[model samples]
Target: MKDTKDSWQDSWFDTCAALLTDPQNLRVWSVIVSLFGDLAQRPGDRLSGGALSRIIMPAGIKPEAIRVALHRLRKDGWIDSARQGRASAHFLTDYGRAQSAEVSPRIYTRAAAAPEAWHLLIAEDGAGQTALDDLLLAEEYFSIARNVALGAGPVPEDIDDDLLVFDASARTVPAWVRLRACPPELSEAAHGLLRDLSQADALLPRTPEAISPLQIATLRMLIVHRWRRVVLRQPDLPAAFFPADWPGPACRAAVFDLLDRLPRPALAELEAE
Candidate 1:
């Protein structure tokens, strides 16, 4: 009976892992970014190469692929590696940590944001176009058109003189506007993640002891990687901005449910493995 149960659990884990794997955006570097952001974004946190390999390799990432990805990330100023004797350790660089910090709140937030106030900034056709573009890039303003941008929360006190600004709220959201705000690809990705999370949740063993720390780490990385891609790309706009069928809220709920079940293991626990 013991052997039979073990076999069943092993098979279930393999299936769940397979279901969670995303081949479409399987860039090793991006996965590493997610892992670091999730587990090692702290000031002094770092992971040895062996630990990194163990955590990421279970997701079908090759050791050589990890080495290549690390090199690319280092070259691109997203990560830094140091060697002490024969062992090497990797950590996010300042730029990388900053980038990770920028999105960590949104990615890890348990509740969705509902901004109390909203505003719009409109630029003259040719006069303030460059300034508006700069604002869109530098700030969290969503671009509605070439000359108009929408922002959440209160209007800024010191506003740009070249642009016209208004404290606004949505009166009506048409299909065209909804499609523009939440594109088909974004919606598809959200639904796909929702399905994957649901399937994995169903297959996961009920007994938490059945799952190993390494397995937990690997699964968390996969979940966070896919979730990060979707959440970061899609702004946290009000429901009116999204189509009625948008799966983002559902996907987020599922993602957090799975994450709560698969709690993060300590760095020492991961490294010990």
Candidate 2:
């Protein structure tokens, strides 16, 4: 088993990466996840806003950012908080736990703290795992996948898209992957995992192993599922998060350019599969 400290650090790192990539409420969500994740390891597995402020605010974030994030997290069912004496104590919800499990199988690798909750990772077949991975990759490559499916439409719209008639078919591919029947709490956890993966890219031990094309396809599928959450949450999110006069106009632009350049069957074709 990995060291407990290492695991904790990895969890927080994942939360950060997800916050940065969040299509909406990026900063707000980051603080909330950071606070709750930290509390998850505390003495009573809980902490108060004042305690959290001492930890997150010193990092130079504004107080408003922390408050907004925490409020939204609570509203969205990712966490629960109450007055513990003079301080506000916070704890993860079952939904948060399930979503966390989705991000890293390691979170669910051992027995659960609650016996009623099932771990989806423990339930997936190898193909299901690959499919989930591919969904994520597909979301990352949405523009490309769309163009490859049916020419070009709009630029990559901040991870949201038109109600693709094909999304239904794509969902079926990962149907075998039995996610723990939980609420949107898992959504927050998924964001947490994304944050960690993005930030800890450098620290994670680089495996020089050769990955198969099938694995890449599976990853793409996972990306799709990951981004689909944003789509479901915000049907009409904005685009062009990049600032004006940004030195690299082509950075995000290049993603769409490549999207239009892909050779595979369009997203429609994948759905037809």
Candidate 3:
């Protein structure tokens, strides 16, 4: 019985590791960003070189790759590293932490929040286009066109006075409008993630003891990383904005289901390992 149990555990670990890996183009730096944001984004939280390596290496990233990524991140002002005697530790810079904090709520939300009220802003063809474009870039407004923008909830008091604003809700979304909101490529990526998550869910072992905390951390990073890529690209538009066959809702459900099963391990627990 002992030998059989051991075999089962070994098989489970291998399968879980494989399932969590990013089959698509693995951007080592982006993966590290996800890890730091998820596990070490607290005000003073930091990860030692060894701890960072241990958390990320399970995804098949090499130590050399990690070194290069850290250098690039530092150069880009996303992270800073300090040395104590022979050991080094890394942490996000204030700018980096702020940027991460800005997106944290969106990335970690288990359920989508659809606002009850929405408003549209329309600019005169050539007169107010630039101001509208700036608003689209600086805020969460979805661009329906060069002169049109959609935002949730009530119109802000600070909106540009030159542009026309009206309270609106989606009534009938045509194919062209839906296609414009969620392009074919984004739809494909969403569907692909859904399939991968479903496969991973099936491969996970029934016994909770079969997995360790570090393993849970690794898996959560992968899940969150992939989900972030999809969700961030998608605005919180009405359901009508999505394609008829968009798999976003289904993908989100699967992601949270697996995440609920793999509860997060404390940072100390991960570092201690």
Candidate 4:
């Protein structure tokens, strides 16, 4: 009976892990980042090599992949490693923690639709277009066209004055604008995540305490990793900007619901097991 129960649990965990893993791509380094962010964000918190392998290997990631990813991250200065006797331990570098902190709110918070206040920036055909392009990558601005961008907040005197600015709000939304805000591929990603989260929810135990801490840690990492890919790519806009069928809100709720059920475990607990 004990062996039968263990087999059942293993099957259940693998199924949930497979459902939550990204279908399109699985970047090992990025997954490590999510795992660290979810589990080891504090300055002194570190995961021993054995613990890291135990949590991540269940997601079908190979031992060699984790090694390569750790090497790459250490080379890029996002992670620092130390020798603990014959074992190794790793922690995020200052630079890496800052990068992770910047996006933590978006990944962890249950956000509502953005405020309605908006403004438009129109640029000269050539050089101005190049200038506006930077805002797309740097700020909350969304690109309407090669030469036009939509943003919020007070107009800045710092940018080129040659560009035109208009403080505006959506009186009417066109199909093209909706499509631009939530393109077909993004819409598909959101829908897929929603479906996967629902499946994971059904598979997990009703009482969170029933699962082992390492299992919970593994499951949380997969959930957060997959959700990060969808949410970070999405622009934070008012509901009117998205397609009528956009599932961003639903996905966000499901992500949080599952996370709440499986509260984050202490690093020591995960490592000891």
Each model's lDDT comes to 0.89, 0.38, 0.86, 0.89
lDDT of 4 by residue, 1-273 (tens): 999988988988999999988888799999999999999998999999999999999889999999999999999989999998899999999999998999988898898547657788998998677778877778878888889888876676676677898888878878999999888988998999999999989999887666899999899999999889888878777788888899999999999999999999998898788
Which regions in candidate 4 have their CA more than 4 angstroms from the true location?
none
- Cα lDDT of candidate 1 equals 0.89
Error of 2 at 254 (Å): 28
Scored by TM-score, the top model is 4
Q: In model 2, what is the error at residue 88, expressed in angstroms? A: 1.1
lDDT of 3 by residue, 82-152 (tens): 99569898999998899899998988887887999999999999978988988998999888988999999
**TM-score of candidate 3 to 2 decimals:** 0.91
- Tell me how far the alpha carbon of residue 192 in candidate 3 is from the true structure, in angstroms, after superposition: 1.3
Please identify model 3 stretches exceeding 4 Å from their true place: 1-11
lDDT of 2 at 259: 20
Model 2 lDDT per residue over 1-273, tens place: 468856754454344333334343446464455334322522335655654554454334567887887788888888778897876777677886555445432221222122221111111444334433444455422221222221122333342222232321121312112221112444454444344334433332333222222222222222233333432332111122112322122222322232222222222232222
Candidate 4 local lDDT, residue 141: 83
What's the TM for model 1? 0.94
Ranking by TM-score: 4, 1, 3, 2
TM-scores of the candidates are: 0.94, 0.33, 0.91, 0.96
